[model samples]
Structures are given as C-alpha cells and as structure tokens.
Target: MHTGDLAVMRKDAYIEIVGRIKDVIIRGGENIYPREIEEFLYAHPKIAEVQVVGVPHERYREKVLAGVIPRDQADPLTLEELRAFCEGRLAHYEIPSRLRILASFPMTVSGRVRKIELREEPARER
Candidate 1:
C-alpha cells in the first residue's frame, strides 16, 4: 500500500507509527520526526513531494536531513526557504540540518518509496 493509505489504515486501527522505526534520529536527546519536516515542505506550492531521513552526525549522534522534489522543474525552491518554512511549523529540533532538491525519488518495483536508499544517498555538496 501507499504510505498515505497505510497511514489511514494505521489511524483506523489506532496504531500510530510515529516515524520510520529505522529513521528516527536521536540527536542531543531529542527524537526528530522526518515526516514532520517532509509534511512542512509539502505545504509549499513549489514542492511536489519530499522525503526526510536521518544521517549520522559526529557530535550530536545523528542529524535530520531532507530531500525535496519540485512540481515545477524550472522553479525549484531553495534550501534556505525550505528551512524557513519548516521552522515556522516545527520545533527547532525537528528541523533538518541538511536539505536536497531532487528530480524524483527512487522507488521500488511496486512503487513504494525506497527510503533505505534515500537515507544512504550522499548529502548535497556544500
């Protein structure tokens, strides 16, 4: 099933899968929700879809990161704007430390998002 469908089914069953069990980042004692960040990005008109993941951090143990796909290919949103948008909707700790804009997400044969691969894609070059 699609993520949205699964989410609705889970809600109906009263089972809340807070985050991808494997994607939750423990940074400085905080539990960061990557979905929250992705949802915030989805609110923007320019964004088509988003995915957020956790990556290892040298100091804080782990850090939040985001990958975005734009609805309009020519007018992609910037990382700073995306971060600012997220800041308005999320707690400080939930904001992503790194952001990337992609043309499309990698998907499985059945069309499920390949989140494991997403989590492993190298961070955008600074």
Candidate 2:
C-alpha cells in the first residue's frame, strides 16, 4: 500500500505505533513512544520515512534512536534538526538521542516495513 494508505489506516486506528513489541524504551521512569518522534520527523519536508528504536543507555536504562530516510539525496536532514522537531512536538523524554539516515527502509516481500528487523540491527558501539 502507499504511504497515504498507511497513514490513513494508522489514523483510523487512533493509535501511534510504538515500534515492534520488543523495541519499546523504558527510561528511568517512563515509557517512551518512538513513533511519536517518527511522526514528528515526518513533518519535515525533506524526510521520506522514519523509524525509531530503543538502544542501551548507561543512565536511563534505554534511550530512543531514530532511523530516517530522506527524500533529498544531496542534503539529508541532520540529527539535531530531527531532535529539535521532536522536542518541540513531544515530551522531552520522547526525543531521540541517536539518528541514522538510510536511502530506503528494509521491507518485507509484501511491502510492509519490518520494524522487527530494524530493531535487531546492532547499535553503534560506544
């Protein structure tokens, strides 16, 4: 289905997706919604698609991470910009601490974005 179709489906459901079942980030005291950050990133004109995941965090138990696909080839949106956009739209704890840009998302044969696969990818070694 098209992006518009997916958007409509999500809207009709009245719930924002929070990554796959295993990817939720539980910070020191709150449950963060990664899809909230992803939706905020979609508001940017240059972004084509976005995904958010939870990765290990030394202080908070887990931190939010964003994976983005930009529409423009020359200048991808910066992590700072994505963070600022999300910060403006979401609770401070929901903002992503790490951001990655990809040319396209990995999808299933049926054209569904496979969030589980994204969540399984190894995080940056710190």
Candidate 3:
C-alpha cells in the first residue's frame, strides 16, 4: 500500500478508494498521517480547510505543522484553539505543534493547494 492508499474490496471483486495518503510526519519514530489529522480538523466549525505538513525537527526528525484557513477570514483560529479542539480526538503526536492560519492558501492553476511549496514557505504571524 504505497502512500497508504486505503481501499475496500467489493464482493464482486472490485476495489474502492476511500482515501489517499497525504504527507507523513515522523515524530519520535512514529509515523503519523496528515489526512487523518486534516479530516479531524475539518469537523471544527471554525476550520474551513486544513493541510498538515511535516516540518524539520532536530530531535524527532520532523514535527507536525498545520496550514489552516478559517471559515471567517476576519476571525482567525489560534494554535491553542485548534489543539484544544483536537485534544483526546487525536493522538498527541498527531496534534499540530505549529499552526499557520492564513486568509487564503497558495494554489495552482488547477485550483489545488501547493503542499510542496507550503512546506518551504515561511508563514505569516498571527
């Protein structure tokens, strides 16, 4: 299962794709998938969209960082708010250690958020 593509086999011998793998965060030797965290964040009323990324870390090799776009641009969500929302629902390692709540995400002509670029760019202060 390269990239952790989740699929379910049908009785008739077909497979269905449920979810595709997003970037993986390795913290203290554990591998955490971003999509799971992203899905959990989506349930929050304030979070309009979110993308989780792995940022460079000296001790753990990588840490979880979330690029979030709030439902209301004027009112932004904070790192604590998001962490509190994700508490208990998500594993400690799965929780975003860094939060970048932006008004809008950088996108491509195809309308897809550029995750690779996001991993490299510096985030604006809250």
* TM-score (all chains, Cα) for each model: 0.77, 0.72, 0.79
Tens digits of per-residue lDDT for model 1, 1-126: 545311224635776555665666788899776765676768888888988887777778778878788888888888787778777578878887777779988999999788777777653332
List the candidate 2 regions with Cα displacement exceeding 4 Å. 1-21, 122-124
Evaluated with TM-score, which candidate comes out highest?
Answer: 3
lDDT of 2 by residue, 84-125 (tens): 676657888888777778888789999977766665574545
Go through the candidates in order and give each one's C-alpha lDDT.
Answer: 0.74, 0.72, 0.81
Indicate which candidate wins on lDDT.
Answer: 3
Q: What TM value does model 2 have?
A: 0.72
Q: For model 1, what is the C-alpha lDDT against the true structure?
A: 0.74
Give per-residue CA lDDT, model 3, range 41-103, as digits (tens): 899999998998888777888788899989998888988998899899888888889988787
In candidate 1, position 6 carries an lDDT of 19
Model 2 residue pairs with clashes: none
Misplaced by over 4 Å in model 1 are: 1-15, 123-126
Candidate 1 vs candidate 3: the TM-score winner is 3
Clashing pairs in 1: none
Lowest summed lDDT across 10 adjacent residues in model 1 is found at 2-11
